[model samples]
Target chain A: MTLAEYKYADTIHRCFRCGYCKFPVNWMDVNNCPAYARFRMETYSCGGRLWLTKAWLSNEIDWSEHLAQILYSCTACKNCEEKCPLRFNVDIFNMIQAARAEMVERGLVPAAVKEFLENVQRHGNPYGNAREGRGEWSQETGIEQYQGQDYLYYVGCVGSYDTRAQQTARTLGKVLLRSGVSFGVLGSEENCDGNEVNALGEETLFEMLAEENVRKFKDLGVTNIVTLSPHSYNAFKNDYAKYDGSFPVLHYTQLLRDLITDGKLDVSGGMNARVTYHDPCFLGRWNGEYDAPRQVLSAIPGIELVEMEKNRESTLCCGGGGGNFYTDFLGGSENSPARIRVREAATTGASVLAVACPNCMTMLEDAVKAEGLEDKLVVKDVSEIVGEVCGIG
Target chain B: MDIIACIKRIPDTSEADTIKIDPSQMSIEKGSLVFKINDWDEYALETAVQLKERTGGSLIAVTVGPKEWDDVLRRALAMGADRAIRVDQDMVAADCHSVAIVLAALTRSLPYDLVLCGAQSEDFGCGQLGVMVAEMLGVPHAALVVGLQEEEGKVRVDRELEAGILESYTIELPALLTIQTGINRPRYISLGGIKRAMKKELQVMSPGELGLTAEMLAPQVKLERLEFPPRGKEAVLIPGTPEESAEHLASILQSAGIF
Candidate 1:
C-alpha cells in the first residue's frame, strides 16, 4: 500500500518521536505504554510504532509479522493521547488504528487476532462458544431476557462467556435487583459491543456488529443501557452514535455510584479493608468518567480507598485492551503492564485491588497469581465488592 | 506445477461437551455447532499455497459438500488459491471410499501435477480418502506427509510413522500426498480477503458433471448407529496426609494389578 492509500498519510509523519507518549501523566517513568513496558524497545512504544507504520506505508520497510506485532501490541489505552504535548495528540490512536486497518485489508495479521475476529464473526463471542450458551451465566440468577424494560443489562462477551467474569455479571445483576432497578438482560440475544473490533481495525466487521446491535436494541425498544463492561460502555456511548444508537448508556459502576448515594442500595454492612482502584482505560481516559467508580467505592462504609501512584487520567492499562486480553501479545513477562500494575497496587499496601471492568478483572487477577502475590493481594471487581457489602449474591 | 488441494468443512467439536448424538442416532447434532475448514485441510492448503508460491504455478482448492461448504473454499481462495471448485454433495454420511471416488473423478478432470488432501477429516477421521483417490486415479501417492520439497519433475516428502519416525520418498510428478498437520502454519483468512475471494473463480459442479453416477460412487462400507461411549468411573481422590495417601494409592494400584 502507498501513502496515498493510507488513511493517516498526512499526519502519520507528525510524530517526531517526542517520547512523551511513553511516560505516565506524572512523568514518573517511560514505561506507561504497555507494549513498551513489556519489551522495553522503542519499536513497541506509541511513537515508535507510528514511525514503523510510516515506513511500512512509504515502502521503506516491508510488512512483516514483527511490524504487525508492534502495531497490534498497542492497548488503545489512550495513554499517549493523555500525555502527548502535541496538538495532534487526539489523532495518534487513530493513526495506529488506521495502520492496523491497512494490515487487515491486506489479509495479514497475527494468527490469534484472526481467530479472535473470526470467532466474533461466527459465534458472536471471541471464545467461539456456542451462542446458545451465552445466557447460561444468568441461569438460576433470575435475570430475565430484555422485554422493553427500563434498562438493558448489557453483559458483554467477557461477562457472558468468561467463567470468572460471569460471577461478577451475576453479582451485578443481584446488586441491581437489591436496588430494585427495573432492568432486564438480553441474555442469548446480546451481541458483541464491537469496541475491540473497532480498536483492532476491522472497520467493516465493526460496522456490521454495530449496525446489527443497534437494530436489535431498537427493535427491543431499549432506551437505557447499563453495561457490565466499560468496553461495551465505550462502544455504546461513543461508537454507536454513528449508527444512530443513541441510547443512554451507563457503565454499571456509574449506576452503582448513583444508587449508593441515593440510598437505593444499602451498603451499611461495612467491610474493613484497604482498597486500591485500577482505572480501566475505557472508563477513565476514553470516556472520562473517573469519578463514578471512586465515588462508589468511597460511599461504602468502613472501606478505605487508597490511590496508586498511577490513577485516573494517567492510570496504566491492565494490558487487556485492543483485544490483547485474548491475543495476549504483551503477556508472559515480569514487565507486563498487568504485573507492573499489581506490584504498584501491592506497594500501596492495599489488600484489595479493585477493578470495575471485566477485562481488567480477568487480566489483573491472573497477573496477581502469576506474580505470586496471591497471599498479599487479591483482585476483586467493584460489583463483587459492592455485592459483599450490600449482602447480595 | 499446477496443484489441487482437497478440503473439507467440519463442525467444531473442540468443546467435547457440546457434542451430542442427534435424534437420528446416525450423526452428531450440528444445529448449535459452528463449522470451519478441517484442521489438516487447512495445513494442506497452506502447503499447496507455499508450493505454488515457490514453483510459480496455480493452486485450485476443491471440496465435495453442499453449498454451505463454499465457505472453506472461499477461505482457500483467500489464502491465495487461484480458483476453487465445489462438487455439490452432502457426503457427510457417505463412507470414505465413496467420497474418494468423487474426488478422483474431479481430480482426473483438472490439470494437476500434484494432488494434496488432508490425511483425515476432523469429523470422520477415516485417514483413507486420499489414498483411495490416488488408487482410483492410478498415481504414486504418499500418506501422513509431514514435510515436502519440490524438485524439477518430482517432489520429496517425509511420511510420519509411529514413535516420531519419518520415512522419506522422492515421488515423480502427477503424485498425490495426504497432508498431516504441522507441515506448515496456515495463513489467516482476513474478511477483506474473503470479500476479494468472492470475485475469484468458484465453480460449482455435480458428480454427474465428472461422468460419475451414484452407483459408480457407492460406498463399500456403511456407517451404523452413532453412540457415545459409556462413562467410566469417576476419579477417586485420596484425601489424607501425603504418606497416608501414598500408602492408599499403593494398595489401590496393587489391587488393580498395576504393580
Candidate 2:
C-alpha cells in the first residue's frame, strides 16, 4: 500500500499544517490526540504523521524503527477525524494507515505489533490462548451454540480470553438470558472480527480474518449479530462489507436499549450508584453511537448517570484501541490516554466508571489501579450493572 | 551468495499457566498448547533475508519437523526467502542432537555459501544445534552472533560475549553462524505475502531421503521426568468487599512492618 494507494496521493498536502486535527470536537482541548498528548510532539500527531508518510513515500526519508514506533503509537481514537477543520481527515488518517500497511508488508512493523498480529493469526485471538479455551467463558452458563438463535452473541477477543473481561462476558450472557432474548454464541468456533487487526495496520491479515469469519457465519446461516465488544461491532458493521459481508450487526448496548424500550426486560429493582459511562472509541467515535449505552443507563432505576466534561463524541480514548491493550505501547506514563481518562472520570465524582465494551472495561480497570483510584473509583461494565439488577451475575 | 537458514517451531511458553506436564511425566501437554516459530530463529531468518537483499542471492529456509511445521517455512518464504524445505519428522520430544544431525545431512545436499541458525530455542535452549551441525558438516562456526556482514567470499560476524563484550571474527566462505536476539529486527510477515508464498514450492523429505535411517536418527538422550519449580511464596487473595480486602492487606503489610 503506497501513499497513492490510500487514494490521497494528490490531495495530501492540502492541510497547510493548521494542526486542528489534534483538537477535540469542542476545540476547547487542542491536545485531544492521544499520541500527541502523550509525547507532546508534533511528530506524533495526525498532520505530522501525514507529512512523514508523504516524505517516506516520496523517498525523502528512509524507514526506521523510530519512525515505525512513532507511527504505531497513534491509537486511531478518531478525534482527528472529528476535529480536522479541512474535512480531509478521512484521507489523512488513511494515509497514516496506508503507511502502516506498507510497513507491515515490508516487515517493518514494531515488535509489539508483530507479536500481536502473530498471536491473533495463530490462536484466533490476540492473547495467543489455546483456541479450545476461546469458548470457555460460556462454560456451564448454558449459552446456546448458534442453533438458530435470534441473534449470534459475538464475544470479541477480550471477552473470551482476558479473565477479568470474561466476567463481563458472562454477565452480558446472564443478562440476555434473563431477558429471555434468543442468542447463541460461536464459542470455540469464533475468530476475531479483525477490528484491532485493521486498526493496527495489518490490513491484509485483517481482511483474511474478516473473510474467514464471514464465510463461517454464512455457512451457519447467521444474519443478525449482537457483539459483546464495540470493536467487533465496528469491524462487522464498517469493514466487513468491503469483503461482501453484510450481516446486520448491533452492539450489545443497542440491543439492550431496544429490549428495555419494548418493555421486554425489567430493571425496576432500584440499585443506587453514581456511575459515569466511558464511550468506547469504536462504539462512539467510529460508529457515532452516542446514545445507546446512555439510554440503557438512564432506563435503569436508582442509577445516577453523571456526565463527564468530555462526553459522547469528544470523549477521551481508553488507549486500548489499535491493540494497545496487548502492546501497552502508551503505558508506563501518567499521561497515557487511559490514565488521563481515569483522572477525568474522577473529576465527575462518579463512584463507578461504567463501560460498554470489554476492551474499555479491561483498560479502564487497569487505569483505575494505576492511578491509585481503585478504592474511590471502581470500573464496572454496563452488562455487569444490568446483570446485577437482573439478579443474575 | 546462497544462504541456508535453519529454523524450528516450538510451543509458545510465554504464559506460565499454559504449561503442564504430560501423564508420562517427561513432556508438556500438547493438546492445548500454542506453537510458534522459535523467537531466536526469527532473527536468524531476518539475518539471512538482509544478507540476500544486500547481495543478490537465493535464500533457502530449512526446518526439521512435521508437515504442520511447514507454516514456519511459509513464514520464512513470506519474509523474502526464495525456497523452503521441511524434513518430515514428528519427534516432539527429540533431543537437539537428532535435529542437528538431520539438519547437517540436509545442508550437505543443498547449495549454500553460508548457513545460519538461531543461538538457541525457546523450549530447549540447548544452544548446541548449530555447533553440532557445523562439527558434522566440518565448517567453521560462530555462536551468539549479533552482527554480520559479507566481505569478498568470507563472512564477518560479531559474537556477543559476556559482560557487553563483542568478539568479531571474519570467517571464510561456507561457514555457519548462530544468530543471537536483537541481531536485526525481523520483518513482519504480511498475510498477503504469505498468501503469495503459499504458491511457492515447499519441499518435504524424510531423513531416509537424506540418506539416514531411523536407527541412525534415533535419539541418544532421554528424559525421565519433568516438574515445575516449586513456588517460593504465595500471596493470599483476600476475597471480600473492597474495604475488607484493603483492611486485610493493610493488616498483613503492618504485621510485616512494611507500612
Best by TM-score: 1
Candidate 1 segments exceeding 4 Å error: B92-94, B163-167, B235-259
Interface root mean square deviation for model 1, in Å?
A: 1.9
Per-candidate fnat, comma-separated? 0.38, 0.75
For model 2, the superposed segments whose C-alpha errors exceed 4 Å read A1-6, B19-32, B89-92, B206-209, B213-219, B222-259
lDDT, model 2, position A49? 83
Per-prediction DockQ: 0.46, 0.58
lDDT of 2 by residue, B66-138 (tens): 8889888988999988989999987646488888889999999999989999999988788999999999999
Q: A1-393, model 2: which lDDT tens digit per residue?
A: 555655678877676778887777677776688888777888888778888888888778899988888888888788888887676766666767777888888888888998889888888888878787889999999888997788999998999999999999998998898889999999999998899889878888898898899999898899799999999999999989998899999999999999999987898885799999999989998999999999998898899999988888788888888888888878889988889999999989999899998888888888898899988898998888888888877
Error of 2 at A94 (Å): 2.2
lDDT of 1: 0.91
CAPRI-style class, candidate 2: medium
Error of 2 at A28 (Å): 0.9
Report the CAPRI category for model 1.
acceptable
